[model samples]
Target: MRYAQVFYISIYLLAVSFKDVLCIVDPVSLSIGAGVGLGALYGFNFMKDQTYCRVTECCNERSIPGNIGNLRDMLQKRLYGQHIVKQQLISALEAHFNPRISSRKPLVMSFHGTPGTGKNFVAEMIAEALYEKGTKSRFVHKYMGRLDFSVEKNVHIYNQRIYRDVVEGITECPRSLFIFDEVDKMPPGVFESLASLVDYNALPNKLDGSKAIFIFLSNLAGVQISDQLAKMLKNGELRENIKLSAFEQILEKASYNLDGGLKKAGLIEQHVIDHYIPFLPLEKKHVYQCTSAEFMKWERYPHKQVIEAMLQEVITYDRAHGLFSTSGCKTIEKKVATEVWIEKQSV
Candidate 1:
């Protein structure tokens, strides 16, 4: 509204200058002509302002409505396994979106796990649920750590570029979601550039990002996280008993010990990130569930024997220690596709 008023005044001044130029040629009718011209300009601006407000109001009312229950239901239906991960994410999102919390910072969630454990899958699901176009939305920006910071010598340039891009994104759409995949590959200074946006303190330039969400996906602490979970399971602790808080310290320590940029950038040390959600390594059972889900997606329901045969095609590692998917469910679809093709050929 303030901007509209400023624009109106600027255009009126331009009209006044043109009126003065015309007055020199027709001095006798200057007052009458000036009054009519200015009145018409004012009337046009008033109508424009009203139309702008009406359009903005209609757009706001048409936006998708979301709540905690809707988010949880979507997660449960789309994501398999990682029950704890889903719960923590829901709680964090609920807190971030609560209207009563005025001092809220941008929601920064770090997903630490191996590939194919649904880290990226969960991120995409959240985007789809929150925004109308899902990941395809212009408001949802994705950055690859490796590609953005590939040259170590140009870290300083990349850092500035990252800061500008993020600030501009939030400026355009305050509710934007920024996903950083393979965060472990980012340079130290590059990731640190985003600290200001994530911090609770208001940015110096007044770029309010409290309504935005920043999701970091990394494979840095996967092994240590899995080891901790395995140890808990061996100690007669139920799988459900393991919570994020229980291994928060261990995960932090392992993340810091690693050579990744996450620790080097001081994100964990500074406590800039809100939630550190650990995605436990998927077991054979979970993989089977993933396989089944993929088949269902293709609308092809194979018999149990065929499903078992498809599972056999996916190679697992370290049977002597404890079996886990080599690449998680990342390649399950491709393997399933091949097996399905082979089965059809045999028939």
Candidate 2:
């Protein structure tokens, strides 16, 4: 409603400026009418071509590996804080549409987490689940990392439109899950355009009155730092009585560990920590520590047994070479050494 009013006012101003040249009369009425007309057109056009699923389930049942129950279970177990997160996501999607039995609603979900924390895998599992639910929906999208861009050419090679198309493709399916993997990779220049899709009023998707929920999976940790840290730095210093907590180091390391080693080179000012949303460092295990076995298995399979044998070898290596901590050895185990040993063997 506010946007419509603003739109008309802008039109009126432009009309008034050119009124003498164009010889227009009743410019205010014309502008107001046009604004309403456009808004109605946008809404009606969206409704006329609006897409919906013919069934409550996806079409490709045989080809999709898992069932809805399995997918739900996987989501519950794998995604930490599963119950509330799942409900919140579902409710958010549901609010956009009517409660119908037919499955044609397109679901767009964004999952955000740290690097190597299984964002892609979770997407795949969700796709498989939606497929089993009897919708023709599949995990049709893919990863587009920084390497995809051509810096010298200066060409804006973007995949967001491609992702948008993938969602549009499943209009006939019951529940389509369009997963934009590593969404944070969308270039800084294109962020505003992307933001439009997320913002309710500015949505570029006027078509289909899309029942599809847009899932944007990102590493929230990354977003939080990039969006926040700097503004908090202007303050003088931490108070003498206040303690400098480990949360500062965690944010610092997280920023540093991002791709391209850019974050690693950047320094976090102490004043920012003192003034901003500072608290305790998360005492959680590192991603690599939790998924060491998974990484090792993915790397070499049965040879992983032999690699497991190298736990002592690598701990000794770390301690002797000052490569890592003795305590870190417990978390990394032989899996870490196996990764290095395998690389050496390959070389």
Candidate 3:
């Protein structure tokens, strides 16, 4: 519209100048000026339309290639101690990419766990696997629930913003991925606003987000999840025997019982989500595995004494019911890096 207005003004100015010169020129010259003015107007309009079309096509056509096998391999390599997470994620991707499925709703997934349990890490890995730029891809957007919905009264405003952002993002890239972190802190209304977008029904808003992915990460069901794990451990059960399906109902119930964003939004009641994958708490061994991986990534030679000493300094374990990293493996990398630097300085 703005360009059209500019083109019209330019044409009008040219006509006025041509008319003024007509009085001082011959009939042939006047005809020539009129012809030249029409040609310029036509050229300008053609350029305007072509430029607009090119810009729109570019925005709508940008997409990244995705591979299921590569994604699975990347998730396995980068994320440790979350075997169920990797398997479930692979399953979800397979179903999402199934050629026979005709659902209009986006692939909605919820990641439940305690802090530092690789919820966010796995989310990033998915993004990285699907796109070459990974989390840095323009199509991959990460939003924090706390920051996005900090104001209670202005939730409606935030909801509109969220909807607009998602729609606009999908419009630009149909294969876009949206990640909501700290979902436990999000308001219920915010998720409600997005329910329609995540539903299986075709969107009346004409936004085709079927190819997009929406991942919700929260610690809402962390305690219940951990309690379930603790009980299994108490019974002398191995971690490998802890299947996700066995306690899915318990996790769902716990999520609904909580006052967190998912419960408030009635996501559980609506069953809008396709998967509710739980991230188990990191054991002391898992933390050690994370530390060892970080040490290798940093090219630090693993010294048993130094590693054990560093673990003691960085890890806070419970004595009563065996050892678990309360912070999960969140701080292990930095702690390991610092320890390695100290060891180098000492040498």
Candidate 4:
């Protein structure tokens, strides 16, 4: 709209100039000459500025708008924390995409955490950041729980398919991101099988050397629960002879009490407490509650004020519930080893 207005104003100025020239020369000749001059000026300016090519596709060497740097810039803009995750991601990118290196590969990140702890939200932010910066990545959300990729054969098939699609997208567009959501739902084999791909040097390649970012978002709860369930079955506590109603009640109460203890310990945020599920490790008396610092790291990024407020909120909730004392939850602090990735410019 702004450009159109400018163009129209320029044309009007040209017409006024022609009118002035008309007072000195013939109207038809002046108008034609002014029009020709204006056209020539516009063409010269457009070509000289290369304004027509907002997004270049000339060659591999031609600069692409959203490349790896754009993605890094975007994530740095969105995420505010001095966590190892961000730094690790940055270092990995730098190493993998370094032109100095003889070969390059895609970056694969595995995000393992409890559900509702903002894993997917972070992934989306990072992906959108990459997109805004000019990289063409495929955000393939392979939700494990919703889909059937658990069997050994099925897991292999799924990984191969994902690998093929991601590679194709990256080759088509030099920089791309391929996200695999709910990866824990797949059999353990899938994770092990892609170990090479996850690592930098061993990235599988097609005829082209270009690569895409590979990411995995997996909920640790599912794997923990499955392991616990298997153990229970082996111990005969969850045998066929065991009553289903009794098991259900025990599971429910265990979950509630475990979640209550976590809240009482001030090791989890109120929102996390609300969404807590009782996995076996927490309920089976096998796992000790995490320290406040560890909990803060797992539950929230290492933002000082945010972690402090979260602990305070948990303490308040615990007090209201008449749960265990929240005395040790205080003095929770974080000493960051790496600089936070905060973009100085709009990503």
Candidate 5:
């Protein structure tokens, strides 16, 4: 809309110049020349800028709008064994995405727990909740710690790329979601590039980090969280009684004392991170629920006896007579499939 006037004036000037050169041209010839020239100039400017989204698939201010109810339902339905993470994440997102009372800071959340405990899964759920295309959305960017910053020698190079990509992403969509997987193995210096991006006052080049969200997934603190859950259960506390407060101090201390992700980074001291969510280990009931869900996903009937048999044969317990699955819900689908394959072969 803003460029329409300029385009029209330029076309008028081109037509006048063409008329001066083609003074003896017929009326039809003049019209054709002017029309073609206008088209040519429009195409040139369109290509020169090259940033315009000709199609409607591009993400703009309204593309990745999130529904808090949808997010809550997704967490409650899909994510199992971590009541604390689901509630904390939902509450934190509500606060961050709230336009009326937002703190004007990027929502920085770190997910800590055992692998397969739904750290990455929850991140994907968040993307799906916010985006039409889910993780495939252009507004969603994921960086693998091992693949993106494998070598410590390239810390400087990684720093530049990290800053450039994050800045570009935030500039494009303020509601962008950036997920960093396996951050436990990420180089400490890598956090340096991201420190300011999560800050409330991060205004490099006037880019607002407040509208974006950053998620870091790590297996760090998994043992501590699991141990705490086990102790709480042993003390006769109901699983539903488990709350964020029980693990909040534990997570804070883990971030400082344990060799967790961003442990050496002082984001905690700067009070940049909004939440440190802990994913609990999967218990018998949660694992059974996951197995049932996986079977349903594969269009297989979730038989009670079959599920019990598979869990018995495949799942590794925390200890003798332990209630928790050491590996959480990580490989439930694979285990289910293998059990089905074996049963088919035997039959």
Candidate 6:
């Protein structure tokens, strides 16, 4: 009885208090008009939400990968021969997104590897896995040194442009991703100004920058990586057992001790980078696996003989002492397409 009285009393108050709607517009309908108008507004908001792409504090699960599973599957099935990359990259992403774990700054990582060794490929995979539109997303920024930073002499210009774009991007969307390809080609200090922005500091509007992600790709330590890989292979150790420590020499060399290295630019000195992932040189077998994956991508079964024939024309072991693909799996897709065309014609 008392609950009924309270509920009725609250309804009465609401009905009376909505004078703006009751008295101004529908003076005659006081009891139910307030509710009618309010309910209409609620319906409008619901419809608006359905129609518009509103960004909430959290990412839209429909657009972004809900967990690390998507990335894990993509890497496991697609990225061959780089077990370390698959393991560490997934782990790093998990920790970064885990609320239980606290990161002081944006998740900054540098990819060091030999050319065609899947550095850019891994970066592309990350973008595709993380963003709804992959590399086409407005929130994902990819910069090539030769093109974006063409005027290397004007390093300051590049810095300002980067700063402006990153700040604008962060303001527009906190979950933005920045990829700088061929970091070695850029002037060492090209990104020095961004160090503070990527650190554990409040952004321009007091926004937390920790949700952002930055990836740097380069072949800076290719030689050192290859040398360590060779040593590991020579010692009969599983390449998967090679730890990040194995690439310490490469890091040291690229870490700014020498001029023109990114470390000299402040990322390493300021402790912004979270990891230096090394993409080991792919063996002939790994290349074969890459070729098979490419064939499957084209909806063709990868017969061993067919793939070897395709590789014979384009495979150039003339470089890197025949240890790895001349260009990793970079050109595998094109080569496969050509072979498929020729084979189809012959058939």
Best by lDDT: 5
Writing each residue's lDDT as its tens digit, candidate 6 over 1-347 gives 45644554455455456644664665567646666657755654454344333442224544555347777898889888898798789988888888888776789988888777888888888878887777787778999987787566798988898889999988877778899997777776788778878977846788777878999888887777777788778889987787877785577566565444384766787777888888888777888888998888778996788778777776666254556666778888888888788879999
lDDT of 4 by residue, 120-199 (tens): 65667555544543323233333443364556557567557655665565556655565666654455444433444434
Query: Once superposed on the true structure, which residue ranges of model 1 sit more than 4 Å away at CA?
Result: 1-68, 342-347
TM-score for predicted model 3 compared with the true structure: 0.79
Scored by CA lDDT, what does every candidate get?
0.76, 0.40, 0.77, 0.43, 0.78, 0.76
Which candidate number would show the highest TM-score if scored against the true structure? Answer: 6
Q: Write the per-residue lDDT of candidate 2 for residues 213-292, one digit (tens) a residue.
A: 44444453533432232223324432222332313354445533554211222112211111111211111232223335
Candidate 5 Cα outliers beyond 4 Å, as residue runs: 1-55, 339-347
Write down the worst ten-residue block by lDDT for model 3: 54-63
Looking at model 5, the pairs that clash are: none
Per-model TM-score on C-alpha atoms:
0.80, 0.40, 0.79, 0.40, 0.81, 0.81
lDDT of 1 by residue, 97-204 (tens): 788887457888888888888999889888877766678867788988888776777878977887888888888677778998987886566676777657876555
Worst 10 residues of 6 by lDDT: 50-59
Candidate RMSDs in Å, in order, are: 7.3, 15.2, 9.1, 19.1, 8.3, 9.2
Give lDDT: candidate 1, residue 312.
Answer: 76
Per-residue lDDT of model 3, residues 1-347, tens digit only: 56855665676677667655764688787778777667766765566446553442222322255677888887777677788898788988888878798766789898998888999888887877777677887889899987877666777897788778888888777788999998778766776668876677545467688989999898977877777888888899898877889568877787677766776465667788888899988887788778888999988777777678777877776444455677888988788777778878999
Error of 4 at 236 (Å): 40
Q: How many residue pairs clash in each candidate?
A: 0, 25, 0, 4, 0, 1
